[model samples]
Target: MRANKYEEVWTRIMFEKIEVLSNKTAITRTEMKQGVITLVKGLNAYFNKEISAQNDAEYINKVWNNFHLCEITMNLIGSLTPKELMEIFPIEKIYDGKKYQTKDWFSAHEAVQQLAQETPISESKEVFDFLWDYHNWDLHIFTVNVIASMNNINKMEKGRGLLEQFLEEQGVRTINKMDMIDVNWEEERDGE
Candidate 1:
């Protein structure tokens, strides 16, 4: 599902997969909670300065989206259900008179509404697509793999498709039901 240029296919997979798993009753709240925690921890390990070196923009370009994908999965853990959030978001303007929120911020608010429901949303798929265009809510596993591989002429010759690439990335490989990290980031951080 790799697109030649500026094509999007990764986020769609994250949304659909997370939505289904989050809603499945058999998955259990315990399972969901554990899943989200593992993602956060693995991501932390990867981004931890002990594991990663201080590098330039080129390094960030390679690792940023995996960091991003980890974040999206964390958010996806929340998007599974509907809940209130009093986040001190930069885009929220201190609840004071200020400029409008960015399109990314606004789209995130829209995504909360769309994914929280039990049933399929009645809104346009385009709207979901638009709202999820942001990196926080998107898993760019495939897109980034294509990008990271472009420099490797041999791997490019191997022609790994999106799923193949996703499997190769740590972002997807590290996810499992091993240990739960606690999803209380919201309860404590957001004071929900």
Candidate 2:
């Protein structure tokens, strides 16, 4: 249940614009980033230790899922609806429709930690690796969006930036996803 680093960032960013949900003091992104980094580092450390003892694939997948949760969470930051956030996350809202019970995200994180600790290394390992890869893609998408949001870029700019950044990360000079029919990866991955 615990949110990954991206979720933490998204949560903080969402708080900055709490007005999107209701009238509340906007939070500073700087403050939010600080807290998120601390949380991620701590979680990473904890995972490293727990994973070391057991190599369960299922438990590892849960960890990866937890990490990917953070990446998908970045989509929740700028202007997405609470329902959209819920769809991406496994968490159910305790509060009506107004706000995301922040505590729920925390609780989810704890659940992931427990799964990581309790699940056997063999069963959980494959899931863990898959989740880890899935989360990487999630992070790539999230980073593009987060940077765009921070720069106050519009949707068009965000899309362009995403393609550019993705290419850069892949060490390619350029990438084109415009021709959906011709793009095999997008067809196979459903454009994620």
Relative to the true structure, how large is the alpha-carbon lDDT of every model? Answer: 0.41, 0.39
Task: Please provide, for model 2 over 1-192, each residue's C-alpha lDDT reduced to its tens digit, 9 standing for 90 to 100.
Answer: 355655555545544433332353554544334333333333333332232324556654544544543443332222222222223433443333225533344453443343334333223333323223222223234443334333322223454455466665776665365433244676779856
TM-score per candidate, chains pooled? 0.30, 0.20
Give model 2's clash tally: 23
Q: Indicate the residue-level lDDT of 98 in model 1.
A: 23
Displacement of residue 167 (Cα, Å) in model 2 is 22
Candidate 1: worst-modelled 10 consecutive residues by lDDT: 84-93
lDDT of 1: 0.41
lDDT of 1 at 9: 32
Which candidate's lDDT is highest? 1
Give me the runs in candidate 2 sitting further than 4 Å from their true place.
Answer: 1-26, 51-61, 69-192
Q: Could you tell me the lDDT of residue 75 within candidate 2?
A: 23
Error of 2 at 168 (Å): 25
Tens digit per residue, CA lDDT, model 1, 57-168:
5554545556455545445444444331212112232222225543444555555555534532223233224323433422333224323434233333455544455555
